[model samples]
Target chain A: MLKNIQEWVMVFLIIGAIILIGNWVGYDILPTAAIPGILTLIAICLLGLIIHRLLPFKLPSIAYIGILGFVLTIPGVPGSTYIVQWTNEVTLLAITTPILAYAGISIGGSWADFAKLGWKTIVVGMCVLIGTFMGSAIIAEIVLRFQGII
Target chain B: MAQQLQRLWKDWRLHTLVLAIVLLTEMIGTHEVSIGPGLILLLPMLYAVIIGIALFFTPLVNEKQTKHAEQLVFLSVTLLIAKFGVQAGPALPKLIAAGPALLLQEFGNLGTIFLALPVAILLGLKRETIGMTHSIGREANIALISDKYGFASPEGRGVMAMYIFGTVFGAIFMGLISGFLSSVTPMHPLSFAMATGIGSGSMAAAGLGPLVAAFPDMSEEIIAFSGASNLASTVTGLYMSIFIALPLTEKMYGWFRGKKDKNPTKIPSRNQRRCYKLC
Candidate 1:
């Protein structure tokens, strides 16, 4: 267990370093704030982990982490200004880039599994996709029309 | 402990590789291509596809490495979800103020399962496959369905098919369709963004990506509303699937086939007991 914890520490250190690099590159793209943004991000991840452990429900850790981050940044919170400053829109983009890329790599790894499902799977997939898109859109349209938000 | 450490190291290396590839592609794409107005939203997804396809063909990584890479999905999802939540935080009051409309939008997001049920039945799918197809078919759905029915079952096969499809094409489709709808439709961007957050994180990103590009100023509010809506979809959608959607789909399948099995096969308690004992 001690060795396992040590390994996780090492892994987090590597992740932290990667986040620094990502933030640096992000600075080039949207040159606003820098280190503080990275700090905010790390804090968010840590908080998310803690909350996930504490929560009883089996929902993903992201849900709790997001709620915590959101609540922390609300208007009346003590350090709301600092939190807002650190989590700039561009910083969010920087954070998203790696996640999306990881998603791509993950999908690539599953290619063999995907291929095994065959052509009928594609047909079923299309039906689901089209159904989801249309269903969501129709609901959105009705709500928008009724509310006159458009 | 040592084994766990080894696994962590493997995952760390895999994450590093993905990060490097993302950065490299982002730099190249930013320099070489001006993506323009319409295509700007799909930039991340495009990069993801390019890198993903390249990784798929290269065979530089072994199967174990790829499996490790897949584990990083939780990290990626957590980060994105937190960011979305934080962004959406201040907008919470506003979102709540518009509660009923938003709820309707969420119902619409879940409307796909109902629409897909008849078609799935028509395709000659079994009860398990039909149920799997009608559900959202995310990782959780797969775990739940597979655990209850076993991975070799028809339900497992159905969920796997949708999972692969959603993983491969869901992002691109959501991105493009949301972009098109936002531009052409008379609906509010907030509603459209909320609608995009049906369940999957990547799918929400794909839908929100274009909306963000189209309305840069409202990006935070858009993220907030969409994130909240996505969370709602994830939590509520799961229960709906288990208690409502799957059962409804099963009945629909029976009705469509015109030969309803009065006595569905129930796995014997003795068989379950034996399986547990073996485990």
Candidate 2:
């Protein structure tokens, strides 16, 4: 358990450093603000972990963190402006890039298992893909048209 | 819990290596190619696939390293989702205003699952495979099915296959389809973004990428809606899958086949294991 905690600390430190460097090079936020912003994110994530554990229903920690982050930025909340300012400086794409990359590597790692699933799997996948795309598009068209957003 | 934590920690080194490689690739891609807006949206998944394939062939990443990368995925997903939630915070009012439409659109996202279930049954798939393929295949779906039914069950195998398929191709397909849909269809960008959020973070990103590129002006709002929609899908979609979709699939299968297999195979309980070492 101690080793796990230590590894987590290292992971956070590495991620924190990357966020700071990205901010500096991209001019997304000032160096002074970057640390606080990243720290705020880390704290929120931890809080989310606690909340997820406490809940009776199984929920992903990300749901709790997202809700917390959103609540903190509401207009009337204390420190809302500061949180918004700091968060605003962080680019969404920058955060997703590494995550997506990691996802890619994970997928690659499972190639052998994936191949074993056979051609039937492809047909199943394609069916899901087409169904989701068409369903979403059809729903969106109807809703947007009804709402006059189209 | 201790064992789970240990497994998560064991992969930290590999996670760090993967992060470094991702960063380097992003830097090079940004510098070398001003990929047109249409193509730029595909970069993340494309780069991920390229790096993944390269790593798959290379000796540098062994099974242990791959396991580590897989373990670290939740961290990245959590960060991305949280950031999205934060971005979506201010747009709460907009989402509320569009609530009814959004809800209906969510049902639409699930429509495919219902469609797939019957077809899968008619195609002669087992009940387990039918239930697995009937829903949007994501990590949570895997855990849920694996916990309820042992990993060795046909349902477990079905989800495993779909999970692999989704992980490998779902995002890429979503990116391309969203881009195509936005151009050809008259759907609102916000609707498209919201639709993209049907459960999976990568799929959400893939769908959002094109919409954001197409309507750069509404990027913030689009992200907000997508985030909120994704959240709704994750929370509500899980229960819906557990209660409604799975059962419905079984019923539909029976209706089509004219018989029901009351005794679905149940494997004896053992130490729960992930379906794939790297997944």
Provide TM-scores for the models.
0.82, 0.81
lDDT digits (tens) for residues A1-150 of candidate 1: 456445545554555455555656643634345556555755776667766766798877767777777888788889887777666634455555565666676677767777787666666676676566667667766776677665
By summed lDDT, the worst window of 10 consecutive residues in model 1 chain B runs over B30-39
Candidate 2: segments with Cα more than 4 A from true spot: A1-9, A19-35, A54-57, B1-16, B28-40, B118-129, B143-153, B255-279
> DockQ for model 2?
0.49
Residue B152 lDDT in candidate 1: 72
Retained true contacts (fraction), each candidate: 0.51, 0.48
Query: Candidate 1: misplaced stretches above 4 Å?
Result: A1-32, B1-13, B28-41, B126-129, B147-150, B259-279
Candidate 2: tens digits of C-alpha lDDT, residues B156-182: 888888888887777777767777666
DockQ of each: 0.51, 0.49
Question: What DockQ would candidate 1 receive versus the native complex?
Answer: 0.51
